[model samples]
Target chain A: MTWGIIGTWRMVHDGLVAASKMLQENKRVGDAIEECVKAVEDYPYYKSVGYGGLPNEEGILEMDAAFMDGDTFEIGGVAGIVDAKNPVSVARALSKQKFNSFRVGEGATKFARLAGFECGNMLTERARRTWELRLDEVKKNNLNPYDGHDTVGVIGLDLSGSMAVATSSSGLFMKKAGRVGDSPLSGSGFYVDSEIGGATATGLGEDLMKGCLSYEIVRLMGEGLSPQAAADKAVYGFHHKLRKRYGKAGAFSLICMNLKGEWGVATNVDFTFSVANESAAPAIYFAKMGQNDTTVIEPITEEWLAAYEKRIKQPIE
Target chain B: MTWGIIGTWRMVHDGLVAASKMLQENKRVGDAIEECVKAVEDYPYYKSVGYGGLPNEEGILEMDAAFMDGDTFEIGGVAGIVDAKNPVSVARALSKQKFNSFRVGEGATKFARLAGFECGNMLTERARRTWELRLDEVKKNNLNPYDGHDTVGVIGLDLSGSMAVATSSSGLFMKKAGRVGDSPLSGSGFYVDSEIGGATATGLGEDLMKGCLSYEIVRLMGEGLSPQAAADKAVYGFHHKLRKRYGKAGAFSLICMNLKGEWGVATNVDFTFSVANESAAPAIYFAKMGQNDTTVIEPITEEWLAAYEKRIKQPIE
Candidate 1:
């Protein structure tokens, strides 16, 4: 059997690595623990997810997150958490705490702080100032405040054949208050199944949520489709439905891993995500958006991924 | 007074040249009409507003178009017309005849055939036979029919202070029948006014219609915004909204001419559209999507305009 986990945000990744280490030592699943730990510590940029993300129009860093364990079908999520240093921790808490499945808004932020996270000061002073100035500019221009940039996610499969997926995002910068995108939404943002595969999404949360793209991707795999086909179908279906409603806007980037150790990736726009496989070094992939009609896929090198990882971990003094 | 016409299809350019000659001899508008007519006939592949465009999902070539005489807002349009040898004629008929607009569908095709244009049978023996072989290969791999592809369009203004715009597309190839895109929809697909400017859109039709992006661009021009600024705002608004709704699936390319005899162009993706002016020749500008986030602008060249004028006399075969 195999087990895995996925998440967005560096802090959350660290926490998951720590937790997985604890579980590995205690539960005696020894083979894949090193890779899982390494994946978390290897990749950095959480602008799309986690507390360090760029703030919205209000100069507040809000977060959305979810975690799922394929073996147990256990899921945990939190949305609209403000000043939470690591929103994924809340999702982890929910998954580990049993009774807590979800949380939202100020309460979730408070819980994270109480749980020993560094909260209430997630944004650096410079970011806050920039956010304030941009907010005013957006207001003057009559633009939406919440149109933030990206989302983050993590997924994994363990040695015992269990899988997990997690996601987080700051939502759109300058979005309306209390706006929840697909990040913390179950099924839409995160899905995991040890017998099939696991998938998570970032960008254009509402469209991903409305179409239930993540879950559908996993479900498609369960129906015996290849990982690539599942990813393509999921993205295509979401686009078709979205075209019927809002036209087009952001993008949806996804990573899925099947039971046999195969992986698939799909997206409508440029995206960045990382992965770690047994016996291989952790790596991140950056897909650049192209000008032509076709969507081309490319992988970022290990060197770039390592450099980015260092950048994310460097603390502001 | 100044008068000019803009067209997007390969043959429509020919028609515009014929019309320009007629108008100059009978009406006396000079360089503007000559340049406008020339711009249409020379551009080999204006995907959004021309013939032989990339087909929609059904592999059928459908067209959307509009023309505006800035002096009177005398406009004519036809959307989703398939099998017509020259959709521009139908659009001209709408302006010249009692009816003034038509939507894409079988009926539109019938009207074109009845009006003496050659209408090719859709998915007849040859097309079906080709599909049968291709479908079997795709089905063997369990792939869905609808995927992703590009669409096309055209817009222009003349020296006589009159403006006209037109557009066409084959819709998405292998698409479900009865799907109408923004091409045929007024305001969404194309808009023109000598007092303000003229604009036309291509890409995701649904988003263009929902946002009324073409009209928005023109209105921005009316508000005294530079054509570039107006186009940027309109495209940005539509892009943001669409991302919020469905992720990013569509884009728009536009050309605008202000009353001051200045021209503007904008787009959200990598695409191209050409313009001809009294002082210069018709020149084609290519915009590469995602390479530069900001829009690019340049003045038309005199030599290009001269060459453009030379190509406008004959009917498009």
Candidate 2:
């Protein structure tokens, strides 16, 4: 049986491995994709996704998430939702509805509660301390507090040839109340087609939404481009075009997988991602821009893993 | 001078004519696009946009709108906003921000207040009466209350070679609180590029976002297809694909204008729209799906106009 899973960011590596094992056990695409993302959401170490994720400017841990089923083209999303244990699950449930599938703010919370989904305060003491320190740092240094937002996006292709994609994020740290990134927005944050493939994005959502890079990558795959070629053409082409048109482009990274279990990635900034397929076991890789509008990727090293472990667990102060 | 304006709905005909006069006067693209949609938003008879729009299930009138600048790809949007006199104007203002450009729910309302934009109760007496009657009808006849959602989208090309697009809607009538449609979404609701032109969508936002038709139309235009061919290929093509994949497709209409003052439109249901250019006077036209996956367009008849006027103002039962 051939099945695969690919996800944005190095943080999802642990979850992808478990999900990949489930795929090996013949899990459904939607269940496997949700499992991959929900694990990351439950982990308290990742600061840009769920639970311990950073808060907005008003000290609120608002979240965004979306799920899409490739076979039915059913999509559901939530923006600026708070106190949800697993937003990916909420999005998956919403996808089954033809109307009111996408909700925002308190309305999203209401839907979660009315649907009998578990809820709790998502803020963490460590996260709160980090927010305080960051606020002080910005006040003292006069620096931009809007930086380092990484959305956990996972795409899964099951043995049944079904595909699904899900994304979750706490959004840009220190963002204004009710501010939403592309994580919950279709085409911008993610797009998947079981017959062709799927793609997802992370980085500066304000810039990512401007290009619709995720949909473009999938369309290219459907047109017979290899996953690598499609990712390169879509990401680099848009990165250059945005810079020329908008004067400068913000950082963004994208990953894609085709129906054949082949995968690819591209980014304007240094990025690390995880992937597992029939030909490869779940593993992390680092990527960066190369010469001639391409991406250079290499397997992650033990040194990097050790440092990341220390960095995430460092004292809040 | 080469300039033009195209807007969805016969309701925007008056606004399009006024904005067309401004475009002829060498008004900037952004200003003209805003003027076009704001008119419909302020009009009481246009119950699906801005003031006097239908309320949600909770009886609160929430609005969604978006603005995009073609030259810079700057986009700003608000979803589930309330009591805003001109949602398109607020969206246009948010487009100027580098961060937190998209706001939702009460946060969107708070941003409007902080920005000093005008505000008023969007729910009108007539709209309330209609909502109450619709609720009764749904309960009595077991009818789906979610019907007749039309977003007013406008695209403009100015003499200075700039282009912009804006969309505003009250979303699906009798929707749940905070339910957002494609009106506030990028790529789905609107996309513009001075080099390639722009496209905006109306009708069934939930289904529209699945195809990212606006981005696909602009992409097709970028690949050298004419505006009409692009619209036909994208709209008709996606309509069939969605039906095949999702088992059904919803009503949708799209309008596009290239950089050369050329325009096109396609729809899956009965639709009316208005357009004007340097070569023609502003006029409303009717469109519907034709044989062989094409759009049939013709000038609106005087009888249709009189009937529409009577239909909007008839006493509620």
Candidate 3:
């Protein structure tokens, strides 16, 4: 069976590589996606995800994560979890919990501890330095809020033909304590259907929640659009919707994959992603949507449809 | 313009009547939905929503609420909020807040306080009696854990043809503290789109979250299905998806309305709702779905589609 994995940002390149190894060892789709997201969280450069990531305004490290197994259609998630080094793992455990599908805050922390996970400080020195600097900036520049865009998510299609997705984030740097974004919540940040495929989103969780962006991408794909086409349309729709209300929109990026292994990434702002499959080694690729790009990447337009109609009438090239 | 409001349970009858009065007074769709949800939350009988509802296992009253404005395509919500008299009002304020779309836990409490909302204990004698009884039942029974359904939600259409939906719940009785259900989440418990319509859900939030039930119903309505048909299909889909794993499914109820003011309700378990429109006074309705029903509610199937097609093609008398 054709299988692959895709995620947003260059930080995930290492994660894709590690995930490829798990696949080589015949790991399950759900396990591999969790590991991939965990690997990215382990990386230090992308300070918006994993351990030692950015802290909330109260100087506490609150994190959110979600894990889904498409074959079973079972999902586990934890939000506002503190002192959990690998929140993704906690989410995985919660997915298997007999009586619950999601847990949050002290409840989440308690679940993590009861699930045999360590509950200790996750803040690192590096993150502390940045937190101090951000706190000072907040005091001086009237910048009580900030945003970061390094969420690590992974969607994998395994040899068993089962698909899975996982996402983890520390949310906006210095965000209000107990402020949850779209990450741990399904449909908005991530969605998977064994029949149609799956999608994961990154960027501003607030806008993504408004549109339920990832689920819309999968829904469009189910309606016969190609993965690339679906991502394009979903991104365009989000941008159009957000622009009308806010005058300008924040960044939004999406990665979509069908069970057949076909995949695509779309973004309102330029972003990078990593992919891995049997045909090639894990590698980084750029989806150029912002000003730096010379090419215009537009969603399916009437002109494109018209050109396709005309092509059918012409001789084979 | 045709304007209406629909909500879960007979308890919402008063709220619907109040909302209809607001619409008659030319209130905005967003405002009416918020006010209706608040009115329900203020009701003392519905022990699953708003202040003084069933407390969590920790004896804390954590409430969840979501508000979506279809005209603006904007949403705001609060989850695991404590000590706020009206979590629905907090959600409304968040929707108008310039910087954030969601808040949860202590952060949500602080935001409410800063926004001039009173924060104090909401526990009531009636709810406390139930909580104490349920806690004893939990201790004595060898029974598998049980789930309850008492969430209250409201969807409204305004004279301007805009749509809005809101949901509020204390979640499952004695649930883990900080455990969020579908209520405050956009897509799962409620979804609104001016172009299509809106949907709200009740019953098990975990299952609802897995299916993104409200959004799916709205999506089906967008795909040309009538509101009743869409709700039926959504409930059936949810059942089919859930039964495969658990061997049984939990209660799921839905209320849907199109932009034209046509509305419908469906539930796998017998449930009642209240509706109000410009054409009539507020009234209670029942949507009963169970084994005893002669006509089985089935998911989208070829036979069903064929029958639908035939019905449409029949000559009008």
Best by TM-score: 2
Predicted candidate 2 versus true structure: per-residue lDDT over B114-148, tens digit per residue = 99999988899999999998889999999988987
lDDT of 1 by residue, A231-291 (tens): 7777765565456434453577777888765667777776665554544334445654343
Question: What's model 1's lDDT at B273?
Answer: 54
- lDDT preference between candidates 1 and 3, better one: 3
Deviating ranges (above 4 Å) for candidate 2? none
Model 3: how far residue B74 lies from native, Å: 1.6
lDDT of 3 by residue, B151-252 (tens): 888889988888999889989887877778888888999999888899999988777777888988898998999988898887886687678854567777
Q: Quick one: ranking by TM-score, best first?
A: 2, 3, 1
Docking class of 2: high
lDDT of 3 at A314: 45
Q: Score each candidate by Cα lDDT.
A: 0.54, 0.93, 0.80
lDDT of each residue in A1-317, candidate 3, tens digit only: 87788887767777788887887677888888887888877765557887768888888889999998777667889888888878999998877754567887777888888879877888877788778877887799987567685678788998888898899999988888888888888898899987788999888887788878788888889899988888888788678767885566778788989888788778887676788787867876767564332224433345644664564234322
Better of 1 and 2 by DockQ: 2
Candidate 3 residue B122 Cα shift, in angstroms, is: 1.3
